[model samples]
Target: MMSLAYFNGNIIGIDDPVIPIDERGHQFGDGVYEVIRFYQGKPFMLKEHLDRLFMSAKAIKLEIGKEQEELEALMLELAGKSGLADADLYVQVTRGVAPRNHLFPKCPASLSITVKPARELSHQVRSEGVHIVLLPDERWQNCYIKSLNLLPNVLAKQEAFEQGCFESVLVRDGMITEGSSTNVFIVKEGKVQTRPLSRYILAGITRLAVKEITGEQGIPFIERAFRPEELLEADEVFLTSTTSEVLAVTAADGRQIGDGQPGPVTRRLYECFQQKIKAM
Candidate 1:
């Protein structure tokens, strides 16, 4: 499988040094991004990803310089060039290359895209489930925006990794918000619950898919805030993202959840998720 990249108007190598030092995205984390996954050479939800990309750009007052359809076409072209049946398409838009300054520059926005092989978790891990640690959410208030300011997330994820965990569940205001890079969910009494869409958590595409799946399956899906304690006491805990479609969390903060294994509801949801992917 080959990887491809596109910067501005030209397609280039993945690691090419095309971005200047003064670029807003390089100097200051002044940008927005999206990660869309293509399954069997077909994007799972291209329009939803593009809509979120534009929404993030608008949130940061960054003009993407290209319309939604134009950007979508460009991403598709780049993904096609990669020649990979399953790929992760990353799109980043910044405020262009200009002298390093705190203010926005009067220049066109920079659009960069890369298509790489899709990463999947090992079957062993998926079956056994993964452990996670609860970390404080030190990120900015605008977590809803898919901005490039990810230092807090990086740190939390690294901490979890170092602790022999798969991911870090972030807690804000004594309540569980989300994972370092995934949306958190809990299953209790045969019902699913997750945090509502707010300025604190992202409106994840996979999370939306899970909501729809629950509806179609006659499963109860509730949107509300829950504390870390509630998460630990839940019968099953799971996470969702573009990459981690439906991952079960068997432990958190060294405490075993449920039977300390992937629960029936989580497995059922994952099976349903795979079916959805197959249907795509």
Candidate 2:
């Protein structure tokens, strides 16, 4: 079956869903977006994703153009129409359509919602983990805002793919920052260490949840930047995102990371994460 999308309140095929060329999101990448997953027809962490979406929009001074509750209802409706019980929902709110200009247009925001099947990680990738290559961070400083400007990430991911890796691990100033589309974490001395919440990285919802779960479960968690050399010496490496959840990085630049397998701590957190979603 063809995928369905909800563009400005209209249900349409994904192939032909329409957005004006003058739309600021298309013209200048002036927009904020979120990707939330659904299991059994219900969105997981819907409230948290919406909260982040609003935070992102506000950071750019763009209005959401709808009540939070109304947006949630509409998203659920779109998910139902798409007939995707297990999928990823993509939603965007742009500064709206207007003549090409750097300044914000005097108009209401334009909303776009699309639903598609969630691509599950290959069993090999999950079980054997994946390779990653370090790249210099070239994104703007305001990476905290989940905006539509993703050229840097795109380039990094493309580089990783070309290098036979699964994801690009970004390093800024010799210190590991994050993955192209996920948060980076390292296990050292039986504790989890990750970059602190800063203007340099997006505060991933899954990242925050994992921190909480680890704390509650008595797993030591630290928020701080570690140098590339430090990451190389760490016991295990992993990346987290809304969809990827907690994924181990078994190899970096052809070097094995802690026996070249997902470590025990990562597996424990992964199990805890799954339990949280099931309980939801």
Judging by lDDT against the true structure, name the best candidate: 1
- What is candidate 2's local distance difference test score? 0.91
Pairs in clash, predicted candidate 1 = none
On residues 1-280, what C-alpha lDDT tens digit does candidate 1 reach at each position? Answer: 6999999899999888898888899889899999999999999888999999999999999999999998988888889989999999999999999998898899999999999999989999899999999999999999999999999999999999999999999999999999999999999999999999999999999999999999999999999999999998999999999999999999999999999999998999889998998998
Clashes (N, CA, C under 3 Å) per candidate:
0, 0
Model 2 agreement with the true structure over 72-188: per-residue lDDT tens digits: 999998888878778899999999989999988899899998899987898888788889999899999999999999999999999999999999999888888899999999999
Query: For candidate 2, what is the TM-score?
Result: 0.97
Misplaced by over 4 Å in model 1 are: none
Error of 2 at 271 (Å): 1.2
